[model samples]
Target: MAQITVVQITCGQCGHKFVLNTSTWPSTIQCPYCQEEMSQDMIPRVKEAWGTASDLNMDFARYHADRNETKFSVDLIAEQVHFPHE
Candidate 1:
């Protein structure tokens, strides 16, 4: 199984916090809450965490649709976490 990297990011426009699957990290993502489009580069990553394949409980292959460049996916969670801004 491929190792997955998990990251927490904050939406620059709406201050919405969410988690992301690095395997599916894309150039841009639509904000889940405000329905605003956000650039991956402009967002603030508040936390970095690790999880195993079993922890993810999802298939990474599904995200790789194009089979060319790497793919990224967004994993939103209900629990809230806070980290000092960098």
Candidate 2:
């Protein structure tokens, strides 16, 4: 099993907040609720707002915290080209 860490993210355009697994953190992403694109540069401002636990932040916290699903998925496949038999 892989250790998963949850990170809170915010949409820079519409101020929507959501939680994502750290493994899936990217430079930019779209807000699930408003479909607004967000950049990594806005993380600091979002963090500050979240720290205060404002009304909107509270709403986000209640709805998006530790949700067991992810908005995106990645698949990796590896094949062995050759195998040696003794």
Candidate 3:
């Protein structure tokens, strides 16, 4: 099973918090709440947690269509685990 690290970040614009599961940490993120642009440096990370393969699979399914555009990839054999929301 692949383990994923989920980063909990807050949106600078709306103060909304969200989880991002990715192998590569992004320098910036789009707020899902207000759709505002925020920099990773500006928002504070609440925690780094672990996510299961099933969580990753769900995330993959949610964003699979934009995988190519986002240049994100998931490795089912990944061993380094990170974090998740709940």
User: Whose lDDT is greatest here?
Assistant: 3
Q: What count of clashes does model 3 give?
A: 8
Better of 2 and 3 by lDDT: 3
lDDT of 3 at 61: 59
Candidate 3 residue spans exceeding 4 A from truth: 1-3, 24-28, 40-86
In TM-score terms, candidate 3 sits at 0.34
lDDT of 3 by residue, 1-86 (tens): 45344566566578777876466555666778998876566434422323454466557755755664342444333244668953
Q: What is the C-alpha RMSD of each candidate to the true structure, in Å?
A: 11.4, 16.7, 13.2
**Candidate 1 C-alpha RMSD relative to the actual structure:** 11.4
lDDT for residue 2 in candidate 1, whole number 0-100:
58
TM-score of 2: 0.32
lDDT of 2 by residue, 1-86 (tens): 32222455555567666775444445565678887776577766654443444444444444554673333322222333666772
Summing lDDT over every window of 10 consecutive residues in candidate 1, give the lowest-scoring window.
45-54
What does the lDDT come to for candidate 2?
0.51
